[model samples]
Target: MLAACRGFVFDLDGCVWQGEVLSPGAGEVLTALHRAGRRIAFLTNNSRATGPAIRAKLHRLGLAFAEHALTPLEIIGSVVAERFGRSRVLVIGAPELTAAVRAGGHDIVDVAAFRTATVVVVGNDFELTYERLAAAARAAAAGAPLVTPNVDPRLPIEGGDFLPGSGAIVAAVATAAGVRPVVVGKPESPLFRMALRRLGLEPAEAAMVGDSLESDVAGGRAVGMRTVLYAPGAPPAPGAADLVVRSFVELARAAGVG
Candidate 1:
C-alpha cells in the first residue's frame, strides 16, 4: 500500500500517541515509512497545542516530518482569518485555540466580559461556564458564525474519564441559539484539502491512519482516501476502516513500508 500511495496522514491523539505516552511501534513505523520515501503528515483535530508544540513533541519522540507537515492550527487559522478578519471573537476553548485565533490576526475577548464581538468561536474550555455559554449564545443569535474547532462530543484523556469536547459546547450553544455552528475539523473541514495541498498529492493517492473511527477514518472516507485504523487499546468500528491494526508496526507492514 505504501508503494501504491504517495503520502500518509495520521490523527494524533489516539492514532499516533495518546497524551504523553507513545502508541506501540509508532516511532518505528514512522521511521520506516520515512526511510521508504513516503510523505507523512499528522492531521489532527486536537486544539490543545500549537503546531510548533506538537512538532516539538513529535521530535522528542524521534518521529520525522517537515515543518509544513502539520495541518491543524494553520488550517484553522486560515479559516478564521478568511471569514472573520479583525473581528472581535469570544473564545471559549483551550489556550492553544485562543492562540490560533490570535495568530490568525483576530481579537480574543472574554465571553461574559465581551460586548462588541461579531463572532463566537467555541472549543473545549476546561473552565467553561454558564455565563460564557449565555454570552456565546447571544453572539450567535446576533448573526455571528458559531465556529467550532472539532465537534467531538467526548475527548479521551490519558487513562482517565472523558471530557466534554468542543462538540459539547457547540451543542449547548446551538440549543440555546437555535442554530448549529460551522464545525471545522476532520471529516468535514478543509483539513484534508490543506493536507493534499501540503503533500502535493491527490486524495486518491493518500492514506489516513488514526484510532478514532469518528474523526480519522470517517475523515479519510469523506475525502475518498484510504483509511487505516490504528488501535492501541481502542478497536475499529464495524465497517469503518479499510484496514485495522493494533500497532503502527503492523500498519507499516500492511502498508508495505518494510
Candidate 2:
C-alpha cells in the first residue's frame, strides 16, 4: 500500500515513539522509505518543541531525515498572519511557540494585554498557571477569539506516563469564555493541507501514518488520503484506518520493503 504513495506523513509522539524511546524499527522504516525515494514529512501536533528542536530529538533517536518537519506553531502563525494581519495575540504555550508566533510577524502581548489582544493562541505550556488561565479566559470572554494549535488532551511521556497538553488549557479558557476555539492542528484541515502542500502531492497520492485514531486516521480520511494506524494491543475499529500495523517492522513489510 505504501509503495504506491509518493509521499508519506508521520505523526511524531505515538507513531514514532512514546516519549524519549524510539518505536521498534522506526529508524529502519524511515531509512527504508528514504532509500525508496518517498517524500517524507514528519508532522507533530506537539507544540512544546520547534522544528529544529524536533529534528535534534529525532537525531538523538537515530532517525535522520531531511529537516522538513511541520508543527502547529508554524501552521497557527500562518493562519494568524493571514486572518488577522499582524494582530496582537495572548499566547499561552512554551517559549518556543511564543517565539514562533512572534517570528510570524504577530505581536506577543503579556497577560495584562489579554483583553486588548485580538486573539488568544494556546499551545503546550508546561508552566501553566491559574493567573494565565484567568487572563486568557477573560480575554476570550471579552471578544478575543480563542485559537489552539491542537486539542490533543494528553501527551505521551516516557515510561508509559502522560502529561496534559495544550488542549487542557484551551478547554479551561473555552469553558470560561463560553466559546469553542478554532483548532489549527491535526484532525483539522489546515495542518493536513500544509503537509500535503509541502509534499507537493495530492491527498490520494500520499499516506498519513500515525498512532492516533482520532487525529491521524480521521484527519487522513477527511483529506482523502490513505491512513495507516500503528497501534499495538488494540483491536482496530471499523473504518478507523485503511491499514493497521503493530510495529514499524510490520509497517515496512506492508509497504513492500524488506
Candidate 3:
C-alpha cells in the first residue's frame, strides 16, 4: 500500500527526528523519495516555530527538498483573522505564537484585561505560569471563545526525553474554563486538507507518516489517506494504520525507496 502512494506527508520532530537528533536513515529515505519525484510535505504542530526557521533546520538536517512546510504558526494567524475578524486576543503561548496572532491583525490584550478579550488563544507556553494560566482560563470562562493550535499531550525532545506539549497546557485551561477549545491543527481537518492540497493528490493517493497515532494516523485516516505509524522501539497498535514501520529505513524499504 505504501509503495503505491504518490505523495508522502511527514510529521516533523518525532517521525523525521527527535529534537536535535535525526531519526536513523531519515535523510537517505527522504532524498531517495525526492529523487524519485514523489510529492512530499512536512507538517508540524510546533506552534513556536516559523516556516523559514523550520526549513532552515531541515536543510541543516540533510533533507534537501524544497517542499512546502506547514507549522501551526503559519496557519494560526489566518485561522483567527478569518474566523473572528479583527478582535482582541488573550494569547497564552510563546512569542512566535503571539506574532502569528498579531500578523493575523488581532490585538493581544493583557491578561489583566481578560474581561475585555474577545477570544482566548492557547498554544505551547514553555515558561507557563499559574498567572498566565489563570488569566486565560478566566477569559474563556467568561464566555470568550477558546482557540488552540493542536492538543498534543507531549512533545519529544533530545535524549529521548519529553516535554509537556501544548495540549498539556491547554488541558488545564479547558478544565478551569469549562470550555472546549476550537482546535485548528492535527486530529483536525484544516491542516490535513491544507497538506493534501499542497500535494495536489486525493487522499487515497497519499500517505501520512508520523509518530503520533492520534494526530497523524487518525487524521490521515479521517481524510481517506493511507497512514503509516512510525513506531520506533515499540509495538504499533493493531489496525491503527494502513502501514506500520519501525524506522524511516523500514519505511523506505516498504515504499521501494533508497
Candidate 4:
C-alpha cells in the first residue's frame, strides 16, 4: 500500500515511540522510507511541545525527515492570528503552546482578565486547577470562542500507561461554559488540509500511519487518504485501516521496503 504513495504522514507519540524511546523497528522503517525518496510529515496533536522540539526529539531517536514537523499549535495559532489579529487570548495549556501563541503575535492574558479574551485555547495542562477552569468557562460563556488542539481523551505514555490528555481539560471547560470547542487537530479537516498542502500531494496519494483508531485512522480516512493502523497485538477493529500491521518491519515490508 505504501509503495504506491508519494507522501506519508506519521503520528508521533504511539506510532514512533512512547515517550523519548523509539519503538521497535521504528528507526529502521523510517530510515528505509526516507531512502525511498518519499515525502514525510510528522503530524502531532501534543501541544506540549513545539515543532523544533519535536524535530529534536526525532533526531535524538535517530530518525530524520526533510520536512519540518507540523503540530496543532502552528495550525491553530495561525488560524487564531488570521482570525483575531493581536487579540487577547486566554490559554490553558503547556508553556510550549503558550509560547507558540505569543510568537504568533497574540496577547496571552491572565484568567482573571478572561473578559477581554477574544479566544480561549485549551491544551494539555498537567498543572490544571479549578481556578483556571472557572476562568476559562466564564470567558467562553461570555462569548469567547473555545478552541482546542485535539479532542483526544487520553494520551499514551511510556510503560504502556495512559494519562488524561487535552480533551479532558477541554471537556471540563466545554461543560462549564455550555459550549463546544473548535478542534483544530487530527480528525479535523484543517490540520489535514495543512499537511496536504505541505506534502504537495492530494489526499488519495498519501498514507497516514498511526496507532490511534480515532485520531489517526479515522482522521486519515476522513481526509480521503489511505490509512494504516499500527495496533500491535490487537485484532483489527473492523474497517479501521486499509492495512493493519503489527510492527514497523511489517509496515516496511508492506510498503515494499526490504
In candidate 3, how many Å is residue 193 off? 1.3
How far residue 59's Cα lies from its native spot in candidate 4, in Å, is 0.5
The local distance difference test score of model 2 is 0.85
Better of 1 and 4 by TM-score: 4
Global CA lDDT of candidate 3, please?
A: 0.89
Best-to-worst ranking by TM-score: 3, 2, 4, 1
Better of 1 and 3 by TM-score: 3
Count the clashes in each prediction. 0, 0, 0, 0
lDDT of candidate 4? 0.86
lDDT of 4 by residue, 140-246 (tens): 99988898888899888888888999998999999999999988888887777788888899999999999988899889999899999998767676777999989
Best by lDDT: 3
TM-score to true structure, per model: 0.88, 0.94, 0.96, 0.94
Q: Best-fitting candidate, measured by TM-score? A: 3
Cα lDDT tens digits, model 3, 1-258, are: 888899999999788989987888888888899888899999998878887888889988887675678888878878887888888999999999999989998999997888999999999998888999999999999998899988999899987899999999999999999999888899887888988998999999999999998899999999999999999877766887888899888899889884
Candidate 1 lDDT at 49 equals: 68
Give each model's whole-structure lDDT: 0.77, 0.85, 0.89, 0.86
Which residue ranges in model 3 land beyond 4 Å of their true spot?
none
How do the residues 123-175 of candidate 1 rate in per-residue lDDT, one tens digit apiece?
Answer: 88888888988998888888887887788787766674577777888899888
